[model samples]
Target chain A: MRFRRWILPGILVIALAITGVWGYNQYKIKKNYETTMQNSYQRMFYDLKDHVENVQVSLSKVLLADSQEQNVILLSQIMQQAYLAEEKLAQLPISHKDTAKTEKFLNQVSDYSYALASNVLEGSPMDQDQKDALLKLQNYTDYLSQELMGVHNKLTEGVFNIGEIKRKEKEDIENANDNMLNVRLVKLEDKMTKSPELIYDGPFSDQVLSGKAKGLGDKKVDIEEAKKIAQEFTGAENTESIEVIEEGEQMDKTAWIPSYTFSIPKESSPEDSPIYIGVSKTGGKVVWMENSRAVNKPKISVEQAIEKGQKYLVEKGYESMESNYSLQYDGLVLINFAYKQNDVTIYTDLIKVKVALDTGDIVGMDAAQYLKAHHDRNIRQPELTQSEARGKVKTDFDVDSARLAIIPKEGAKEYLCYEFKGTYQGGDFIVYVDAITGKEVKILKIIKDENGTLTF
Target chain B: MKKAVLILSMAMLVTLSATGYYLYINNQNQNNFSSTTEGINSVEVSNAEKNKDGVEESETVNATLAPKVLYWGSTGQDVKDVQWKLAQWDYYNGAVDGIYGTETYRAVRAFQSKNGLGVDGVVGPETAAALGLNFGPVDGGTQGAGTTAISRNDDIYLLARAVHAEARGEPYIGKVAVAAVILNRVENPSFPNTIASVIYQPLAFTAVADGQINLSPDADSLKAARDAINGWDPTYGCRYYWNPATSTSKWIWSRQVVIKYGKHWFGN
Candidate 1:
């Protein structure tokens, strides 16, 4: 009876020790995971704080800047900072619904700053309204930075836990919003939305962009119609070879306007990079297309490439198009064709055609600019004669040649000028001359690297 | 006049880039980087001449007589020289800073009126000539001119085409290896002395025999070609490559394998 009593108690003691070790290891693993998660949250918070601080500093610089050049730099900096802050904000593991307003506020700041910078660079002084808007933005950002700093300090002191808030957000967003950080951010966004309406011509102005492609007309295109537009653009019709799959949202955010994206295979194999073509649901206009497949051999000359590109443009209802410039890379030549309205070159309306040099196939095309800006333009007749414009060009340099071309000015301004392609000191340059004023406007030097040409 | 205009216009249209009737004008415009003070504040000639932003050209404000020219606020080392030269000539009695400030502007106007040139207060081709500076479009940030240079365009294209055909489906490194193999052969006296001779030698690359080599190449192939030319030999100077799946010759297997990159087994 004494031996049996000892056995039962001894077994109980061993079982308790085993449970103790297992529990300790489990606790250690969980603690490590929590620390890692907390570190990332702290990193993002610090990054947000730094960017917001930069935004404030750059904004103050903008107000104090006396020169337009300095002002442009400051504005560009503010834009970059705002964009970076918004990017970091997206990385947070907070509830999406709660952070939506905060994210929108950051997006506006980025968009607004970019538009202002673009305007300032164009020699247009910021008007009273723009100044007022910027002052408000600066003050608002100052407030945001101060509040973020408070949250960060509190987080580091263990007074508030960002990790806890994020974990709770996954379970219950309302419970997460009860946290001070979310409440404060939401309040800041609300205040920003209530600020004076920003109405201007800069690209970020939602009112101006309309998000609707102007050149596409008013035809409502369904999925089937969109497929036909894709077929016409890629010439991938009547073939079992090309697999067409519709994509809801695009991975690349280059295009300003949203469209119905379609992924179509260029070859029969499953592994090849498929051509991604975006067609606007309205009017069935082909906005953009990219073929990521590797081009083969250069069996055709550059002239053949241009000829093939031109033919494809004409077949797709692109009329009055003249090839602007061609850049050769790999086995393909990307030719930028701008729409010609009258004798004037409408540079704002541009379409890029990628022609394969091996077989002269149109592998890629991007018509976003063309679709957004194309319209019948009322071009004015120039006051100065072509000879008068020519006279203004440097007489010493080998003038090589000159032609009438309308190039974009700051923002949406367009100038009908004489474009002179000349060689000076053995380097090539293109100089633009305002036709009416007979004044030399801008000069761009073409840099020929061993790889290819880059102009500035 | 009409005949002269017609000829000039025709020449302009036909005068493409370095190559004729093929490439278009390069479109990489101004960087909009305004870190430093741009020289010359004078109603700077602008490409945005007229459209919607009614910020009229400052030069064109009052004087159709001044003509479009470079004036105040222009920033460059040349501008400093212009200032120093003008100050030395007693035409401009201002600080010899490169900036075309108000003082420089006044001096330029005074000098132009005194010299019987139009008193537009701007530097035109005539004023530039009077100043004795070679007034061609000289930019400070221009890429420095290179000497001893000539590129074989046909060679780059051929190499790119060959790489694209043989390994279009392969990884980027494998693609470079394909181009590097051709380059390695060109260096080896045992093979060929030039890229063209090695790639076109009879019974060599399989793509040449089939018409696959004639297919168009993509951007990656071109990048690979450029890299190969720039001396990036990822194959460590290997001489030959053959797919292990199809190599039937017993003699080819005798060479020591360098690397089995992607589908091809490379050897020297």
Candidate 2:
């Protein structure tokens, strides 16, 4: 009886304690959840709002701009911005059913904006239909911005409590990285290299040498046969002065790169002798050829020829050159020089040097092989003055700006040149003039409105 | 004295019985409430027992929560083609594995970033719906309600196809030209608000036209496209390419020439 009398009171006190603890936990959880939701909503809302505003600003510029090109660009911008904003908005797990209407409204804005931009990019003249669509889009974007602002205000005021849920959603997102749409493509290639093979079609019967033809190394070139092959390839008129030299002791392992020798009249000087050089990877036919005055002459000793060639290169303003050990072929000695110009180092392997037949003194050198193999290189140099070279430009163009830079030229090293930048009829152009000669060399223009622009 | 004792014991027993009855009724009510909360009906309990004849279906379901068909073979072409296609979406998911896995999915998600589509990893009906192309039936063993499971290699292939069609013959320089053009559009008074909108606003790229952008790309094209995204601009500063051989459009070529690449010349 005594125990029973006290048990009821103890039980009442325990129940009160349990109720208090449970109520406290509920309040804490509710607060945390609300905070999470608010944060997510704020982030998403702000992002969407910013995108919409950007579109609005861009579109406004185009709508008010005088240039038709600018308007077209703005139209594209409007669609892109609107679409991005809507996509982001859709990512949010909004419990508010009313937001569905907002989404539909955003879709409408997207359709309208895209249609207008597409027409503009296609160079279609803007008409009343486009203008009406654009104006409506602007108004719709304004409404969206205001709606997001209201949501932001409510969030700040602590009106909701679903933050924990939102946080969990974000966690799911991080877990589902595979769901990401940003695909980076990795290119896989064959580990080994393959040479391009072009089949050789025949040139058998009797024909005369007419057009350009190349020679293969060690794989002897029968001059009579080569003449016919050239004639068949180009269908050009005939030529005569063809000769075949004796096979040397060292046969090049590769049949592609061949060395050949031909003589001009004894009366022709090294610089005046008309020489033809051709290159072909195939044994029979040439793919590339060039005709130029011979730069090297028959010489005596290899050592004498190399020394003399070095002297000529030095006098021609080349400094700090690296030379290859002498390579003797037939009756001539070949020496190579790798020369440096400013920041660029040029490798000229075919500096075929020659010594005089009588005195054995160094006499001739060739840079033909090196020039044909090389391309204009990239190098650093001092800036040039565009102002001085501006006199050469035509008065028809309105020059906007001028700059000094290194301009690339074919068969030449990069040089400090004057670049004159200007606009003509709304087109951007850059005119390059040689700094030393004040000669107009190249004209490059930057095309505007190429990718199609996005507006409000 | 005996009468008084009996009266007290009876009163005690009556009180004890009343308390026991109250506790029993409360326990029964609690059990009912719990069953309601859990939504576990008696019929379901019977079904659960039957299913657990030997192996537990519940346990199996819990163990294999991940969806089947984890791999998506290349969506288009071969491995090389898939690599190129993925490159277009700006997702360098590595060499096309021809298997759909985490990398491919991540790449797909990233691609969706610039698109106005939901960034769900599964290429679901919504994504397929948005693509709006008549892609032949997917080759998975089963067609789930939402996303069809694809091999990683298949994803790579599909991605490659898209990249190739969108950006073949376009080197890093071409990519830069394309990027510059996009930027120019952004800065211009007219154009779309975001990059995604511009690329996907429909009928923009030739690849996107006639559903070619949905195909896979080869390895070479993929590398070229990637280099472009990395800021290689071969176009220098010119934009616009139209094949003189096939282009019927009259206005694109009318612009002044700014530069040339391969066979096409770009102008403003």
Which predicted model would earn the best lDDT? 1
- lDDT of candidate model 1 versus the reference: 0.62
Whole-model Cα lDDT per candidate? 0.62, 0.42
Q: What tens digits encode model 1's per-residue C-alpha lDDT throughout A1-456?
A: 868645644554555455555555555555665666566667767898899899999998888888888888888888778866765565455543345445555656666777777667756788888888889888888888987887877777887777677456446545767887777776766765665455655433545433445687877878777777777777775434444442212211322444565667655665775666667766788776666555554689877888898899998899788886666655577777878876777777887787788777777777766776776677878888877887887776667776777876533557889888777777667778888777776676554433233221
TM-score of chain A of 1: 0.64
- Residue lDDT tens for model 2, A1-456: 878665655554555555556555555554554554355445655787798788767756766766667776776776567766755554444321213344434544555555455455546666765565556556555555655566556556766432333334345533222221100000000110111111111111011111112112235565555655544332334535443322222212211133333222222353442322232223443322222221233334545555666775665433455453343322333345554445333432223343343344433434333433333445444334556688888776678766555533322234556666676555556677777667676665432211111110
Q: Taking the tens digit of each residue's C-alpha lDDT, what string does model 2 give over B152-179?
A: 2222223334446655665333333354
Q: Per-residue lDDT tens digits of candidate 1, residues B1-268?
A: 6456555544543442122212111110111101000111111221121221111121121101112246878755456656755775678777766688888888888878888877887776567546533243222244435211122333566678789888988866578769978876654323323454455442366575344665555557866675565444445456677777876555467655655456886666
Worst 10 residues of 2 chain A by lDDT: A183-192
Model 2 alpha-carbon miss at residue A411, Å: 54
